[model samples]
Target: MSARARRWPLVLLLGGTLLLSGCGLFGGDEEEDPPAELLKFKPSLQLRKAWSARVGDGSEHLRLGLSPATDGTLVYAAAHDGRVAAFEAGSGKRRWAAKTRLPLSGGPATDGELVVAGSSNGEVIALRAADGKRRWVGRVSSEVLAAPAIGGGLVLVRGVDGKLTALRQDDGSEAWFVQQSVPRLSVRGTGAPVIAGNVVLAGFDNGKVAAYEMSDGTLLWETLLTPPRGRTEVDRLVDINATIRVVGEDVYVVGYHGSVALLALESGQVLWARELSSYNEFALDFLNIYVSTETSEVVALSRRNGREAWRIATLLNRDVSGPAAWKNSVVVGDFEGYLHWFNAANGELQARMRAGSKRIALAPLVVGELLVAQSEDGKLYAFSERGKR
Candidate 1:
């Protein structure tokens, strides 16, 4: 593959292809962009492991959207073996676990009342957040490759068929549906819809971002982050498979072979756009935004105008997870299950910790005080930093 062809999952965006063959997007041969060798560095910060637990047989080599999420107190996570569990945010105590018995892929979204997760077979399983009892099961159009969004009396799920289906919170029933046209080639997973005040924002595989009314699924506005190019479909891919972030009144989204642009919340208008290609979600704070590029370069940009603050290519081709910002530090995991923390002010490597040897495919979730990560083999870990090294 040429430099222009170095994009994400080149598989045909079929309904079920992503479930089994997503490893193609995450791996390559020795000749094509070999994994970058890691450089040894002294630890400057003490990132002690808070806790670790087995999340059950996890996604394995598949590229699933299962990640950890938290509601202020309890942390929730799901796995491919139909296991969804809740843990105490601080102590890592096993609160509850629900076995839905579906090939679960996306989510375990929580709002303290209900914990919801999606399946690779288009099933949305909702459970009681208190006891992990199964509440309701709803079906979507196709495979759910992303986490469902929970808010506003509705649970929003984006299926691989390009449909965004909204289910009633109390009972799992379809309330409204809106869908976009899929491209010939797309990445494996889809980004979860984000719920703000009255609007829910999401990006699609069609290289566009749209906003819809959370009340009745009305289309608010749509903006294309970038237009696809090149004679080959590989070069023209602009899938926004990574979840978009909404900060106050601004929305930030990045895609494969597309521009990472800041958009106005009310209207899907692009405020500032920059040419940076990525398929992973980002870590955002009051000061700066951090993203892991397609080749695994961690770059920090200004939240105001998308200006480059600093970047480090030491982890290139390591298949780094998306960055997580906590306590003025940026955290990311690599294919080798090593968690690296960097100084937010500059791109200096401060500390590193190995969770295991499995690949960490998703971004670490910063829940209150602890930073949580999940490995491909279904292991969950929590880390917290201290002043002493």
Candidate 2:
């Protein structure tokens, strides 16, 4: 078989294997053990449900880029069925709902005035935040798998086709497009571009992260976070599927079968790197970085250097979402629809809650003292510490 054909197992292994049916890593014939049952744990912190509302039929099986976006007062969420709803952040009451009539694949990015979403057929739709009225629609080159980001008067989108297209936020006019070479075989996700001042930072399937000038898509600098290795295409896969995280003047990013590196924001220089592989986005606090490894291990590393702080390995092979830091604890969701909280200082389990019957595929959004989570079954829930109430 050709190299590309041989890599199909790896693509499926990384993307849909765990979600659909349990498949052995690298297509092995061994039967895998089922995920471990939730261990009984003592509660150190109490979490109570504040409220929850239905968005629509959630992403279902499409794994669309539907995540809740918030702007202090309101929260926005989209369903795969093209229904977008805005809710009051405090009360969880529906503000308005808009129907784009297109298969929504990405977004709910808001600049407080306009909210943008992407369709499965490459259409970018913008709606007025005040009421769910259609503002404008633009087109990109391919399917959008990441949430659209708005900043610097431009709405930026990263398409599966390796193109980063920026549209004028006011009228949805094309501003500029930046293209990169895509590997033949890659994991099934895209890293959403992040805007820092006048620069747009984006990661590609080729394992490279590049910085571009937001004004005209001019290339500022590019660095290879992971270099493909091994003989077969499957072994050579190194997609940087995780969204880049920018803290202060440094950028933190990881790849599928690659390393996690801290890069200087202005010069794209690698400050430090450690051999680690993860596709899930990470969370950072003042002292440490929390990441969910591909094997479902949640690890904490020192922010000053890439030294290991702590790791929780009992959740391995469970398909957990990225970590999100809330208050004094770090939170993560799993395929079994449960949210697990751990103490930030030590990796000890502190609390757990079930948000839905289906998987909680994305990290819970942290809005002040409230934790907002969207389940795969279309349920949006808000939670807060029991002591706060």
Tell me, by TM-score, which candidate is best. Answer: 1
lDDT of 1 by residue, 205-294 (tens): 899899999999999999989999988766888899889999889999998988888999988888998899998988898889899998
Predicted candidate 2 versus true structure: per-residue lDDT over 40-95, tens digit per residue: 97898888989999988866545667788998889999988889999998889999
- Give the TM-score comparing model 2 with the true structure, all chains together: 0.93
Which pairs in model 2 have colliding backbones? none
Model 1 weakest lDDT span, ten residues long: 1-10
- Give the candidate number with the greatest lDDT: 1
Q: Report lDDT (CA) for all predictions.
A: 0.85, 0.84
Per-residue lDDT of 66 in model 2: 77
TM-score for each of the candidates: 0.94, 0.93
